[model samples]
Target: MEGNNDTVVTEFILLGLSHHPRAQAMLFGVFLVVYLVTLLGNGLMVVLIFVSPLLHNPMYFFLSNLSFLDIFYTTSSVPQMLVNCFSHQPTISFEGCIAQMYVGLFLGIAECFLLAVMAYDRLAAVCSPLHYTLIMSKRLCIQLATISWAAALLLTLIAVVLQPTRFCGHNVINHFSCELQAFLKIACSDTSLNDLLIMTNSIFVLIIPFCFILVTYGRISLAVMRIQSAKGRSKAFSTCGSHIVVVTVFYGSAMSMYLHPQGKISSDRGKMISLFYGAVTPMLNPLIYSLRNKDVKGAFWRLLGKKVSE
Candidate 1:
């Protein structure tokens, strides 16, 4: 049965953060600096993790992969957005839009799961120190990372494949990039199934991981409290603090953008929030994790010393 179709959208115009001429230069400079920092920060982490034998543990191994994902995750959308900040017409082809959406969703979801897995790794290391190595072995770390990537890819594939069936009402996308929610709003087809699928996916990919992180942190807190020495408790809390902060920002902003009702909020306002999670969060993660970490700082100094000696 063929449904009534009025029009087909071949491309989408991305109404990025602002259209002001003066704001363009400022936004470009800001994002350019951010992009450079994001690249350098994440790239350095990956290199350090690979080169430094001290960082060969499962935690750093996962962190290396997380850094790599963050790099690509930001690259997938931010560059284009930056380009659009200067371009007269910021349009993405229909196919390009779909691709961007796919990559963004895949990496975003993967990061969520990866963070939870990292939390679990930390929990095992802190709460069960004796069995830490046994539980988070290299093989198990590889398996967990593989599962995170595979699950994200599978979900993204499903969402993209289902998208073609939906009718495109308009070619304009209000956000800076092609997002699932923004695209769904313009879909003329009955989107009940799509909405249901998105909700289910959110529960699995977002909510489940959030629950795991929360539970793990709860256990970690209990374990920290049990420590007799103040120094031990403080050390434990400090080690987990960075991860907790990263998780909070990433998940908090994402949930606010996706799960919250868009009722009275303007589309432009929503776009700014989306930009924070989708672009800004990825850029900030590596900096937050590495800059605040003693291990990472020590690794950086050693790497720099080696460079200086050469």
Candidate 2:
């Protein structure tokens, strides 16, 4: 089904999670529950940050943005996955695919940058506590969040717009969602530039922020060690524990997904990893933050009390 240079692909089929009814049915239920919880968890984070004055600082500001991005990141894929599970034909139009790719890429990259910003915030809080307020000012936090969203969107937009996706003979995408790599696999045309761009962007997202996080955390760790009081050192480390846990979960999957050489990882592994970051991790983020950080727990209780009183 290879088309000539003049070939135009109007639609593409997605060979979703499984073909077996029982598998699909079971997956459908699981995905639906995860998607709902993702929305609820992230949505609640966003709302609580906005309404709770106690949580309106830079750390929570970046966190709310993360929650916001996670909401859309999961939304960009999981709904389609859920639909495809029940659908006789998991088909997406060319336009729909492009939209999905752009949204997913934007959010994915933004989250990377946002996490780096969070790392810097932690460094400031731990390594330079006296000036933490000035370092992660509300103004700076907003600027970082804005840059994360805008930079990711604009850069990805340039790539998607510059490279015209031409599907010659191949139109079957063997994934639940219109992932950029999966879409590229199905494009039956010259994709050298697109592949190069994906590689470059992926590398940038994977390397720069990750290096920064590691370095900042290293510095923070050193600073914590310098604290003479056991209680002081323990508190400082506690502040970072939740974020470190999150960073580990996120970067582990992201690195495996993006940094590996092309075609080395199986598509099945890719899908599972994608599900890990896209769906599962968002649900885990709030729980990690809440369970580990007493500030979050106290804030949650306070918010709940107000609601109960009302």
Candidate 3:
């Protein structure tokens, strides 16, 4: 309970993205736009998929889940970061920080697994078109979705339960939000067990799922190459184009952040890396999926026409 000088640390001060008044103002505007776009974009995707029967299949089913995750992921942390941007002395109660850390970790891990499940769906659609529906039945889809969420919950609980309990040092977290790694730096208790747990969970939640995605995409590529008609090949590639982009952008920054050796990267650079996935990636998901796909556009037009006719 006692921190430095035998003081109890009850709150953590967040050194937000910037300290300069002008810079903080600019960051506030930028992140505010990003937060709003992330909400509207991901929110629209969920609603669009829900109403469009054309998007009722496994691909969009998974996409709708992804959209929901993106919404939750950004909402969990971005609002707090935005508030910290304007506060003269941005601080969060120790309990608030713990809650933020766990929620953010769970959503992030869930996305990692959900993306891998999506890759498998793509594999089925491309590699076995005739049996794609049979392979990705509603039951299997629900099971995969449930497992992704349940696994993330289990892993996050383990990390939190085994985390270093005592905080006997300074309570300044260098990052904007209560990031797990940033919070861990402020812990006064021994963190070897926590470190091991993070690494183990990262392997399951990041490295393994990412590798699975890569291999699944490789098989899809091979299957596409064997398609006899040019139109067929193009269509197959188009079906997966958005997912591939999302996976690359999400996993690239995430793996770089988690898998790389800790303490080797600078604090500011680490914040930038986190910002990409935490803010930028969620904003890009709906854009990437909608802009590149003909199905979503067609569904939008159809819905628009139905509304006008009514």
What TM-score would each prediction reach against the true structure? 0.94, 0.94, 0.96
Give the number of the best model, judged by lDDT. Answer: 3
Instruction: Give the Å error, residue 21, model 3.
Output: 2.1
Please write out the lDDT profile of model 1 over residues 1-310, one tens digit for every residue: 1246556667888877557768777888878887888899889999999988888999898899899998998898888889899876799988899889989999999998899999999999889999999999889999999999998899988887677455545777788789878877777677777777777887898788999999999999999999999988887887899899889888887877667533335677777787777778777878877776778889889999999999
- In model 1, where do residues sit more than 4 Å from their true spots? 1-5, 164-169, 261-265
**Predicted structure 1, TM vs. truth:** 0.94
lDDT of all the models against the reference? 0.84, 0.82, 0.87
Candidate 3 colliding pairs, count? 0
Expressed as tens digits, the lDDT of each residue in 143-199 for candidate 3 is: 999999999999988887787767765788999899887878778788777877777
Q: lDDT per residue, candidate 2, 1-310, as tens digits?
A: 2345545677878887657778899999999999888888888888888888888788898899889888888989888888889787789887898888788888888888989999999888887888989888878888888888888888888786755445665778878888777777766567777767777887778788888999999999999999999999888888788888888888889888877655667888887788877788887877777667777777778889998999
Worst window of 10 by summed lDDT in candidate 2: 1-10
Which scores better on lDDT, 2 or 3?
3
The best candidate in terms of TM-score:
3
